[model samples]
Target: MSSSALDVQIKSLPNQPGVYQYFDSEEKILYVGKAKNIKKRVSSYFTKQHDYGKTKVLVKKIASIKHIVVNTETDALLLENNLIKKYQPRYNVLLKDDKSYPWICIKKERFPRVFSTRRVFKDGSEYFGPYTSMKTVKTLLELIKGLYQLRTCNYHLSEQKINSRKYKVCLEYHLGNCKGACEGLETEASYHKNIESIRDILKGNFKSSLQQFKTQMKNFAESMQFEDAQRIKEKIEVLENYQAKSTVVNPKISNVDVFSIVSDESYGYINFLQLAYGSIIRSHTLEIKKKLDETEEELLTLGVTEIRQRFNSQSKEVYLPIPLDLGENLKITIPKLGDKKHILDLSKRNAMYYRMDRLKQIKITDPDRHANRIMAQMKADLRLTEEPRHIECFDNSNIQGTNPVAACVVFKNGKPSKRDYRHFNIKTVEGPDDFASMEEVVYRRYKRLLDEEQNLPQLIIIDGGKGQLSSALKSLEVLNLRGKIAIIGIAKRLEELFYPDDPIPLYLDKKSETLKIIQQLRNEAHRFGIEHHRNRRSKGALQTELENIPGIGEQTIVELMKQFKSVKRISKATKTELTEVIGNSRAQKIINYYNKE
Candidate 1:
């Protein structure tokens, strides 16, 4: 952070606890943090050099500071968390998910049906969870089915319906799968009791279900029903196995929400774990894209709100890796060590895995959005006024001076726009003069766009050093577009960026997205131009071969070429066909010349 900017912000900084945000010159939030003493903590950033490369880059980008004052340190923490969640600054961690997690819902019909779903309806029904994975929901459902004979059918089992005998027992009843509640073979009281037991099991409370199964097994064995006793014992084992997968943390740390964050250069992932009686009832990770520079706290805060909102979280307390303000009523804990810390670490690990998964998903599902992010990063890196959404790059291909040509390759949104690509044959330039050829092609390209009033590119890239860039500038000057469009040149040797009048070149990081896109443009333009140049040279050679013939006039050659496309095709032509194309006088001469050869 610059001292000039800090000097002013620190003077107004409150001695009390609060959240602070850093912003660049464009006023985009870079990072969000909480401090007991806003002045002291923020001052520490400018006073010393940071060891981390990311931190140093962040400090240099900081143009201004903003803070929100609060009463206690806890309040500051809460506010910081809220802000981080809200803005999701680039330096802060971010978690984002557009869809809600799958939940196990017990429909509120007569003889409620249990199933897994991702939607949350307001109709009166019991919803077990917004589980992190559908696999978990499927496993729990299988366990419940094994433990108790629940109806899978969606039939109305009201007393009037059952008495009317309107519904018949399906295959499930005959297969010993259901209790035949539709025929009233099993009473509503018994069905409700089983459902209640399943509810407890979904909440990670397996005690009641286990005890009931054990009692049933003991009674069956005592009554000499060995087969029923064995079946009941199997059900007990299944329920226990399901419970064992969960119940990893200390059970006493009940009803606590744990959140942790992991981030990359362009994105952040935050994982949320909902614990009920020391078992993870629900766990999920959210993916977020960083707009500027966000911190871990900011990302976690945002993830918490999104996860809570999507899954309909009502937990009042949340455990996080760092202290921050989420709200006045919500309790926030930052564990120093022990079980809580272990759980927090586990949350961070989930976030890390989620980040990797999302990166792969993005490359496949939404490549356009990924390209936009890369373009936005380039815009910021280049200090360009606008994103280079539509870029046009020019390369001159005057190889060996045989047939001078140039190519203009267009990129609409960080990908090649082949239809808009153009090749020039250097109409106004002579010899191996690249500067003159560049001036002519650039003028022709834009002059037509001006006459037609067509769209212009946000940026123009010249595929050489300052010499080529300056020559292109002259045409822009003639067209009165010197300042209207942003232009730069890339030197091939060192990949240096050159501005119009600036002597010093800006060297972007070799791994930066901006540099990558520029290299793509340069390579594409060179490729496009070289292809056009080769075609022109081959075509010229074919025409020039006929020019070597004696007494072959220009008009006669034109007539022959119009009839025959290639030299090979013309040589294959009969005397009659040649006479028809160029008439008897030239055709006989041409045939005689070829016959002599």
Candidate 2:
């Protein structure tokens, strides 16, 4: 941490227990630590001997340090936990798990059946695993179903109508594997006994069960029971076939993870894989360049440590992309030939492709090239006196004639400055009048800029024709901002560009790069504006419904609506909970009215 920043911050700190945070220039928290003596513990980082390795790197980037004094060490510890959970600092140990893993579930029914599922919800079923791969889980379920002759039908055994003609035996009965309990062809006791045997097999007693079946087959053959012997022989064959097909790539390399990093000058990607019984159980591609500030080697080291901390380990064999002297039992190699090389090559290719595909999906083009072309063209077309550096766009959205709203989005050097984006909930305009709504939004947005003495944008783009352009210009004039800013309106059809005084809009050639750049900006503004409007309108509609409730007038309704944001949420609140918002008597009345309804 910067000594000056730490010194300035520590001056205000009380000589009490608390948690402190060190932040880098990018506003990212570099480290979070708690101490009994808040000032002394935080100041230790500024001392000369403490500056080395990760700490040295952290200290160099430190722009500011902050401290929060607490009542006691326990309070500091609790606050530290909450901060760690919230910020998830890069240096901290984080647990990791694949969010979309599949599981095998057996429903709680009279004749319980096993099935593969990806989703887990609040249903009374016995669930096993978070299997790494859906295909692997599905294959296992198929093998179990084939061997046990379990019912694959959706109908629960208890829900199935007893003594009904619809309960006919399926194909499994024809193979003599199924005890035909479906049609009352076999006693319930015998069917349940078979199900219990299946449950044992599912619990991974395949070897013991197979041996027992083989022994039974031999005894039947010796007693000249050909039919029974044949049945047992078939069961043994199924088990043997499964064992043969389930080949382990490396028996020694069970339950491990492998990670690799690939990067160019500007960006890097981390490729990770989880293995079980030497098979790739799960794979992940993480885009790490956006979060990293270190070199390739530092990123590799940090990535390995971070991932290891994040995930559980069953084995010591963690494969790496490059060799490091961590003194662990990890096998670090850069394979040049053979199966290991092939797998490594596959991982590298996957990482590269993943990075490329992500970049393409996001339409991440060179900002400098596009920005330069657009700025040049805009100055020439709009007859501006100077090049536009900061551009602001306005757009309005609503449904039919309800909850009209507008959005103001800012772009600094062709990238959105999200922190500066503003939204206006059409207060002055009541209905779906786009021109009037646009005027209100523009007026409110620039009024703040003037009031705050903030820098005005060199260019303003509105998503409409001449009417919208005139409204925007009028708003600027009312605020005495005209001539201080250059403005144009973009229309969707024919890709027309209109000015406030122009009677006819100008259409740029479709092939022009400048036109494409402007179109991208205009579309982005529209998308952002529409999204905010929809959210505000939805919330407003919900709030209006809260106001309609008995004993809930506008003011109480506003507080309740602002507190909970929805009718469904308000419905779940009790009288005491409602009292926390308004008061005891009013809360009771509101609760009673809702209860009665």
All candidates: TM-score: 0.57, 0.39
Which parts of model 1 have CA positions greater than 4 angstroms off? 1-126, 131-143, 151-174, 178-303, 309-324, 327-378, 387-390, 410-422, 425-457, 465-484, 491-520, 550-565, 577-585
Give the distance in Å from residue 508's predicted Cα in candidate 1 to where it truly belongs. Answer: 6.8
Scored by lDDT, model 2 comes in at 0.69
Q: Per-residue lDDT tens digits of candidate 1, residues 1-597?
A: 566756887787878788888899888989888777888888888888775557888888888998888887656654665676678677765544445678899999777888898888999998877777888889888888887788998777789999999999999999998989998899988988998998888877888899999999999999999999999998888877777778878877877888888765477777889987678988877777765466677666666766776677777888988786666778888888998999899998888777667756876899976776777677877778888888999999989987999999999888899999999888877799988989999999999999999999999999989889999999999999999999999999999999988999999989666898899999999999999999998778866777777778667777777888777787777889988888777777767766777
lDDT per prediction?
Answer: 0.83, 0.69
lDDT of 2 by residue, 1-597 (tens): 456655777676767888888788778898776677887776666665642256667767777878888876646655765676578787543423344667777777666667777777667986655655577777777666665656655554443564655677778778765666666676666656656655545443355667778888999999999998997788788877765554234523445667778764335677776655445655666555323234666556545544554433344666666775433455666667765555566677778888667645554566564455456556655567777778888888886777787778888866678898877788988668988888888898989888999999988999888888988888999999888888989888778888767778887768554576678777877788788878877667765666666677778877887888777788889887888999998888777767888
Mark the 10 consecutive residues where model 1 has the least summed lDDT.
92-101
- Lowest-sum lDDT 10-residue window in model 2: 306-315
